[model samples]
Target: MIETAAREQRSAEPVVRPVRPRKLGKVPFVELADGRLQGVVSSGSDLARVYVSSISAATHGFSCSTNNNRPCGGLSGGSPCKHLRALADEAVLQYGLDRVTRYLRVEAGDDDDLMSRLDGTREAAPAAGVFSRFLRHLAYLELPGSTAPIAEMHWFPAVSAEVR
Candidate 1:
């Protein structure tokens, strides 16, 4: 059923990025939790956790890593790799114009209201079952990385059922 469909989607090859940045697809389903914007993108048959952190003092800007425990090729050595950029583009698209415009006005800083809401969400525990798993998977991004945290002002209405 749902598991089979998700597996099928995961098995599909990752969308090839053009030589230059271009719209690849809609933001792969994402969530704002624990003061981070998190999403899992399939790289070939592997799952990579991609995230933007909201903590101002953190070291890195963004990071991506696969389920197999490999750092994203782009994120290694603190580079702004294509994978990270694609994920950000997707997130902005998902966030929409109104939010992006506001995010821009704030200089993508932590002071934005949207960031505050998401950061505050950390105080409230994530729901049980699916949400917990989704949080766990996304939480992997918090491991040592090159980026600082930034709140995800745009809230995803509901958790994606894709978490297994």
Candidate 2:
């Protein structure tokens, strides 16, 4: 009877183990045109755009708002978030700025005026407005959904205990 009771008690006890959060993987490097290793870049002129895109892609997804301020999980509310850093790092590794600039010039097309508008070297123009809207749409596609609503819908941080 005593042995049976002890066994039952031991079986009822819960086991506990340490838990660790998963780590984000490192970004890969791309080769550049200058015989120097760098990350992938569409063009030198597009470097700023690319940097913004990558960072926004990495951190803008599923953000929460508290007190009217948005906080991104991957970035923790930092400007020029990790995604931007990774993109820049990759770009430096893949191509020097010179190559990137040439690429941008080639890609910008006959609309030299549009390029200048984006570069902010000229007065605000109608084309700039259209381009801005297009970029906003792209950003929307990259980061979808409101994290605040999701958080309000769920209860998190489950309780755990250990028995010895």
Candidate 3:
């Protein structure tokens, strides 16, 4: 039976115990009205890597202008933020690693486009203008390896100016 095969598959892998959802904190996910799911993964070490990689690719030569902006400077807190945690959780729950890898590729493409645009326009824009543009661009990025917006979640402020 298909169920037996699925059980066997699950058993063969190292158990990735379902983390308590609350442990993901502010990372958010949505259950659609039709029972489909969509949202950003915002937690876990692997997920953090995905997000950091995406941000780095997107803003290659740019310094973050916002004092509160943490993405470009690296995860500023002791650990990955809730946004990254939620994104990772959703990826695992829905598509697994294969899909997650594909999603990251797509996100990287988007970041490349943004970087191209920024490169084209940076000469004409002021620093603040560029920063604002970056934020606006970020708003439109579908969370890498996800089809949904990085859920609107509050991330804890970086604990110190020293980048981790």
Candidate 4:
């Protein structure tokens, strides 16, 4: 579910820019992690499949592959595929435009969107590490909610609410 609370004013809290959450139907997991905007994105053609996608900050080096490590067929065109686009769109929804563009080190030109400004080259990166972390997050969701904190949750980064 998207955070409706993100719409409320936080004027008293001293926040210069407030976050705006969005409901991501295709992107179940997204994070500004590992110096990139990375997450698990559902396949458009198959319900049982997903792609691990990431766009590196500044350099915007990109990668998209199946959990088993097969490269996406869409990458040969020298442009970002649908999966990578969805990942960026959802990243903006989750992190807000200002924060995401800043993290990606992208400077706006005209009214162009985030994807258009990205200058990236496909780099084959390992899918296992990101997939592994997403799995851990899903596992935590299976636990019963309790007031008492779990010891391991302490190690979770406080940077974003999606992880918690």
lDDT string, candidate 3, 1-164, tens digits = 33444545553333333322343333333221111122333334543322221112222222222223334233353233344334444544444443343433333332232222222111111234333443455677665576666544223222332222
Better of 1 and 4 by lDDT: 4
lDDT string, candidate 1, 32-114, tens digits: 34444455454543334332222111222344555334455654455444544454455555654344434333335434433
How many collisions per candidate? 11, 13, 13, 0
TM-score of 1: 0.38
**How well does model 2 score by local distance difference test?**
0.32
lDDT of 1 at 130: 25
| Higher-ranked by lDDT: 1 or 2 | 1
User: On residues 73-149, what C-alpha lDDT tens digit does candidate 2 reach at each position?
Assistant: 34454333444345444443344343443533323333332122222111111223223443555587688677566
Tens digits of per-residue lDDT, candidate 4, 128-160, equal 889998999899979987997687754443453
Model 2 misplaced stretches (Cα beyond 4 Å): 1-25, 29-78, 102-164
Worst 10 residues of 2 by lDDT: 55-64
State every prediction's TM-score relative to the real structure: 0.38, 0.23, 0.23, 0.75
Model 2: per-residue Cα lDDT at residue 45: 40
Cα deviation in Å at residue 120, candidate 2? 11
